[model samples]
Target: MNKYLLTIFTLFIAMSGFAESPDSTEIAIKEIEQSLQYQTGTIKLKEGHGTLIVPKGFHFLDQEQSKYVLSDLWGNPEDNTIIGMLFPIHVGVLDDHSWGFTISYDPMGYVKDDDANTINYDDLLASNKKDILAENQERLNSGYGTIELIGWASTPYYDSNKKVLHWAKEIKFDGDSANTLNYNLRVLGREGIYLVNAVASMDELPEVNKNLDQLIASVQFDNGYKYEDYTDGDQIASWTVGGLVAGKILAKTGFFAAILKFWKIIAVGIAGGFSFLWKKIRGRNENDTIEAPTKPIQEENDEDSTKS
Candidate 1:
């Protein structure tokens, strides 16, 4: 009986400990979903060129009668005149104590084929990768601050005429572990909407790499929104990523464990009751009284008076 009781008590303690640990995947998804829901209205696409860059403080926007809304860092609605396609980039969560990081990207819209095809083949085919870095360095030296390189990858892109000329770069980031995850999709060229990508990190936990591919896959251009519609074939793109993050957030938040916490509460109550009963019993035994006091009398004097 004692062994059985001890086993149950040990199990109770173990379960209580498990309840304290939190999951990040679960937390991130919910957070992502909440952010998406509030994001309503239309996003006015901002355009940029290969050489002539878009001005700073530019952003996506949507006025009334739109399903999405975007603003500049200063909260001003982005201008539609220069807008092209929406690119949502960098979506993630960062926690300091756990040490984590995540980043992702999604692309959309179509740029002019001839314009996109104008790539510096000689520069790209050059044997020295350092040359590319050197050029980036020159730009930094001129006016741009120190540039931090994350990771980059190039994928093939084809136009309606089956002309393969465009490519996309996947960029990552590094910074304070506690910084809120940032997602930015700057429309460099119109082809496809770029999914929002971001990196998240926690100080103690391993970085939870954000999967941009999933977000990218979620995109679907509205009907007749493709390059073909504007140029030759089709250009419409459409996608949704809230669900992917939602799953991760659910896992990380320990929401599953929330149900388990109910059992923990019961265990705690039983343990507390046992402790109270044990204390009460111990106190009663420890405070037991030994004996009662009695009084003496003047019996001799009373007998003498009776005899007289």
Candidate 2:
């Protein structure tokens, strides 16, 4: 979601790094966690397309509770698109150290993986950084701070056998000391893909990495929708696995709404011209900027040629 005003109060907690919790807030948060009924074992994903096996030492929440926690407790905007969330069983959703996976699926048509092994990620990352740089002015124009793509937190990896692709990103928002971890996993299917994104601060990198394999294994599309079930004449996706990891898909699909953890934007302050201090639900409002005007700026830059 970029730095457009969607930082989780939970993220704020993580960034605060051991800030003492107010007794009332602490008790209220704990009561909220206790109030919900979390699920375990086999869980069906949105629209019965696939299934998520609540992996060992984790718990699952359906869309309702997930939205409440994300928008209400964590300070993310009201995103009705989320199918659910996954949390470590040991951690309270209110815990400062808490982190979880927000789940959603996109039927963007069958994704062909022929280019999987052919991509040069180093070159791709450079291109992505350029895209991010190009969008900063727009971010400022829309009342958000610039996003700094610090590079990959984990290099992209494709599992041909499993029909899944996963990667991690290191991102920094202006005016914040701590960086956000944007971990992404994509599961290809006959009609679309499942997006499993883990949102956390940089300090949780090791734990997230350690648990990724099993997490990737948790999502399984139903028989006819499985990647291997792609028959001739199926609707093909416009982008490939590389595009998913590059954040380009955000413009074309609803796949990775939280990729930048629009929930990661807490406060934004710009020096000259634009300044935004955000403190409320800010994720979905920023989603409007998805197809926001980057190319138009390129067209404006072409003014030099026009004058000549």
Candidate 3:
């Protein structure tokens, strides 16, 4: 009997320990929802994962052109606000070669040129000089071929094609790596994606590589996501240092389904487990209090019987 009672007590203690706590997912979701206010949609928290996707006109990027032109109650386009949809993002991949955009909140952690200079896609486009373009071409023809030029820029190859300026940057991974075709990115068209930024490194990061591919696959475009007039040039063998391209491209990449599945399981599981533990602890504490008074009453009755 004693052995049985001790075993039961141990089991109860273990369950109670788990029941008293909230999981990380539940706490994170609650905090995220409170921090971000949703205007027209809902916030769904998945188990074990801290991911949210606010699909409708949510600005994930917060650069200068990312503001929303909102109309007033009178329905006139008079009020402009910082509008954004919050999507569920996870650290599915990390390391270099994985493609992703810089969060408006993150100040560091991106690719730079050999001179340790950072490239801004917008600033570079606005600052390109005619003399610099000519000098770059001369070097390319002489077989020095050292300059890095992207498809959407005013480079000679892109300008020649004029109609297909939708092509973005081409990066050279390891010249020895077998996955060249897929890795050589042709931003397809300007209608499909927004070029955030690019970072580079020499480490072999499989998870980051996989996630980068996944991110690329998740890109899509809406009805207005088409590019009307643009130019393209012949493919350059290399990209010049300090050059960049950033724009809102079309969303043709297919990544939503995978992202959904991975995070949903994590968020739900964490929240559910935490809530269950909290209830169990409360119940155990109540039982202990109820038994306390009965023990004293039984002791008093035993003393009276012994005196009689």
Q: Which candidate is the best by lDDT?
A: 2
TM-score against native, each model = 0.27, 0.74, 0.22
- Least well predicted 10-residue stretch by lDDT in candidate 3: 299-308
lDDT agreement with native, every candidate? 0.25, 0.63, 0.25
Q: Using lDDT, rank the candidates from best to worst.
A: 2, 1, 3
Instruction: Write the candidate numbers in order of decreasing TM-score.
Output: 2, 1, 3
Candidate 1 to truth, TM = 0.27
Please estimate how well model 3 matches the true structure, expressed as its whole-model Cα lDDT.
Answer: 0.25
TM-score of 2: 0.74
Q: Write the per-residue lDDT of candidate 2 for residues 246-278, one digit (tens) a residue.
A: 544221112122222222222211111111222
Off by over 4 Å in 2: 1-21, 249-308
lDDT of 1 by residue, 83-129 (tens): 22222223211111111111112243353444334444334333223
Candidate 2: clashing pairs of residues: 6-263, 6-265, 7-264, 7-265
Candidate 2 has its poorest 10 consecutive residues by lDDT at: 299-308
RMSD per candidate (Å) reads 29.8, 10.3, 24.8
